[model samples]
Target chain A: MTRDDLDVDPDELYGRLKAYEGRTAASGGTGRDPVNEPMIRHWCEAMGDTNPAYPAVAPPTMLQAWTMGGLAGHPGGSARSEAYDELLALLDDVGCTSVVATDCEQEYPRPLRPGDRVTFDAVIESVSPRKTTRLGTGYFVTTRMNVRAGDGELVGTHRFRILKYAPARPKNAPKPEPAPKPGLTADPARRPRPVINRDNAGFWEGVARHQLLIQRCLDCATPRFPWLPGCGACGSLRWEAFEASGTGTVFSYVVMHHPPFPAFDPPYAVALIELAEGVRMVSGITGVPYDKVRIGMPVELEFLRVDEELELPVFRGAEA
Target chain B: MTARTGDELPPLRIPITRTLIVAGALASRDYQDVHHDAEAAREKGSPDIFMNILTTNGLVGRYITDHFGPRARLRKVAIRLGAPNYPGDEMVLTGQITSVAEGTAEVAVIGKNGIGHHVTGTVTVQLPSDAPGTTDASRTDAPGAIDAPRTDAPRTATTPDTPR
Candidate 1:
C-alpha cells in the first residue's frame, strides 16, 4: 500500500505471486463485442495497411483485439477473476506498482471473420521470480488466453507477458538517461554486420573489389539483386555474377530518428534502390538529406568502407 | 511472386509518434493506462505510453503481407518482444524468406527500434497459387519474363526460388 511496506520479504512476496500460477485469470469470458468490420477498418487504418483482403475476414492478429476490454472495462460484466486482482494488489502493496507489457505471441489455427461472436478463457500461465531490469526489479506475469468462436471452435491463442516492477529510480531523482541497449554502440567496430553465407559470399567479394554484382540465372538470364542462388523467374539453380552499371533510382526509403545508436548518425536515409538492371537492393542512401530522398530520385552505386573489416555497397543520391 | 527461400524483403521504416502509439492501442481495443496515459505510464516505469503487443502483432502481420501481396494469408506468426516501442522512436522492419515449400513460405522478421530489437519472429504465409515463385512447375516463364507484373511490393526484386 505504501513504500513503507518495503519490509515485505522478497522470497515471501515472490512465493505469493508465484502461487497464482496456473489459476484461471478469466473464464467463460464472452467478448464485449463480436468481430466486426468497423474495428477491422480502424485497425487497418491506424496501421496504414491497405491490403484488400481485410474487411472480408478479420486479420488473424485481431484474434485478441476482439477479446480486449477497453476503458469501459467489459461493460457487460466482469469475466475476470479475483485471483488476478489479488495478484496485482499484492504487487501494488509492495510498491511494484508500475506495469508495462513486454511480450506477446499468438498462433491462429483459423481465420477470424466478421459476425463471429468471440469467447475466451485465460489462465495465469507463469510468474517469474523477482528480477532486476533497466526498468526496475519485478516479476514477469504471463497469461495464456484461448480465443474461440461462437461454435466453440478454437480460433487462436494469445500469450501476453507484463513486467510489474518498481521504478528503478524515484520520480524526484535527477532524470535518468535512456538505458544503454546491447548491440548499440558509438564504436565503429560495433556496426551491424551483414549475413554472409556461401550463396551470397560472392556478392560481398564483389563489393570488396568495388564491383557491384547482380546475380543472373545463367539458364534464364534473369538478373536478381541481393544475390539469390536460384532464379525466381525460371527456377534455375545456375547463376553467374553480372556487373551492374552503378545507376539506380530510389524506389522507396525511410528516415531514421530516435533512440540514437552510437555507430551511426540519426535522421539518415535508408533506401530501396531499383538498379538499371531491373533489380532492387536495400542500402544506405548518401549525399541527400533524409527528407529529400524521394522515390524515383537518381542514385549511383558506391562501396562505403564502414570499417576496417567491412565494405558495404551503398548508393549516392543527389541532394534536392 | 518472388516469395522464395533465402530472399529478403526490403526494410520498412515506421515512424514512432504519439498519435500512432495511442491510435494503435485504441484501435486494438487495448485501453491499458500505460498505453494511453503518459503520466500513468511514467508512474508505471515507462518513459511514455508504449505500443501494445496486439498492435505489434498487427504491424508484423502487415509487414509480411505488405510485401507478399493482399491475398497472402498468414497461417502462423510466432514472435518474441524485446525492447519497448516508445514514441519519438522508429522501427525498421526487415524480413528474410527462410523456407519455402509448395505455395507457402516462412519468413524470419525483425523489428528494431531505437533501443534495440522491438520484435523478432517468424511468419508462415500462404501465397496464392498463381503468385510468382511458387516453387517447382509454377515457373510460368523464363529470363525476360522477369518483368511480369507481380502482386508483391512495386520495384522489389523477384528473388524467386532459392535451393529448398
Candidate 2:
C-alpha cells in the first residue's frame, strides 16, 4: 500500500500515542497490564519449556507478554488497533491490496511477572520501497515498540516489519540459499548422551516406566523441570512427580537443514508441544514427513533410546 | 495490643549494568542500537542505550536466585521495568515477605535506581520448609513438567546414500 492510500491521519496517530504515553505515566510506573499466573502459564505452555527455571521462576518470555499491554483499558492502543485491518484499510485507501508480515524481532532485558505495570511507546522506525516479484511493488514499514514499566524502567522492546504490497503476489520469490536451522546440536559420538540432570531425574525415571512425568514443587505447586532441591515457592525442599497423558499439540516448530550434532540428521523437525496437562516441552517430531509439522497439530509422545542409559522423548501424529 | 510475631526478611539488592545488556543481547534479541550501542542510541533520542526489558527480567531472576542460594528453587518472579536504566545506573532490588501459605512464602519485589523505583514485582519461592520425603511426587506429572524421552518410533537405520 502506498502512503497515499492510507486514510489514517497523522494527527490521530499522534493523539493516540500521546494518550497512551499519558496513561502509562499516570499508572505510577506499573505496566498497563498486570502480569498474572494464567498469562505466564500460557507463554510457558506455548514454548514447551519445562525448565524449572521457568515455571519454577517466571520465564523470561512471560515478562514480554506482561509488558505487552492488555487488549483493552491498557497502555497503547496500537496493539489494540486491529493493526492488520487498519493497515489493510490504509492500503486500500492508498490503492494497495495486500500486505504481509515479513519479519519481527523482540529483545528483553528480563522476564515480566505479576504486579509489574508496563507501558509501550511505539514509532514507525522506517518505511522503504522494495522491488516487486510476482506481487506488485511494495513498501516495508518497520515499527519499533519500546516498553517500560510505569516508573519509567526499561522492560523490553520489539521490532515488527510489515510489508505492504499492491495487488499482492500469488507466491513469494524463492531464495537462492536455504534458511538457517535453529537450536544447538552435537556429534553422535561426541554428543553428550542426554543425561538425566538432577533437575530432571524423575522425568527420566518416569520414562523408564513408560509414563511421562513432570516436576512440581511442593512449595508453590508450580510444575517445571531441572528440578531444584527446594521448591521455587517458599523454598520448600519437597517435590512431586506426576504422570502425563503424553498427548499434545505442536505449538511451534522448525526443520533443521544444518545438523548441529552427528546424532541428529539434517531436515529434522523440532517442536514445542503443549501437552494436555497445561505444560509445554521441546522435543523432536518423528513418524511423519517434516513438512507435515504445523502449529496446533495433534501429537503424542514416544521415547527413543538415544544411548544405553538415556531415552529421548519424541512426538508423532496422534491417531484421530 | 496484639503482638507482632514475624521477623521481616532482609531486602535484596541487585546491580544493573552494561554487562547484563550484553548477556541479554547474546541470547538472540533484536530490539536495536539503544540496547548496546551508545552512540547510535544517542542519535535515536535516548539518553543512553537503555537496558532491554528481557535483561531486566533476567537480572531480577538472578537477584532472587543469588540470595536464595543455588539450591533454592525459584518458583515464580515477576517484575515490571519502570524507567530507562542507563549503563551507569545502579539498580537496587528489594523484596519483603507478603505471606506464607502451605510452606510457601510470597515476596513483594521492587527495584530502584536510587533516584526512583525502576521495577516492581513479586516472587513465590519454595523453601526447605516441609519434612524430607513428604513432598508429593505426583505433582511433577504436568505436561512439560520436565524433559522427557521422545515417543516416536525410531526410523529404520539406513545408511545415508551420501558418505560423510
Query: Each prediction's DockQ?
Result: 0.25, 0.02
Q: lDDT of each prediction vs. the true structure?
A: 0.80, 0.53
Off by over 4 Å in 2: A1-320, B1-13, B28-31, B71-75, B128-164
Candidate 2 per-residue lDDT over residues B40-153, each given as its tens digit: 654333445666655555555555444443334455555544445665445656665676565455666666653345566676655443312124424444332122322233
lDDT, candidate 1, B117-138, per-residue tens: 7888889988766666774455
lDDT of 1 at B164: 17
Per-residue accuracy of model 1 over A1-320 as CA lDDT, tens digit each: 12322447988888888899999999889887888899999999888787788999898888878887877868767778789989988988887887877777777888888889989999999999887766677788999999899689999888888888787767655444544423345334368888999989998888889999889889988898777778999999998898899999999998875334557666588899999999999999878778689999999998888788888889999765
What local lDDT does model 2 show for residue B11? Answer: 51
lDDT of 1 at B67: 78
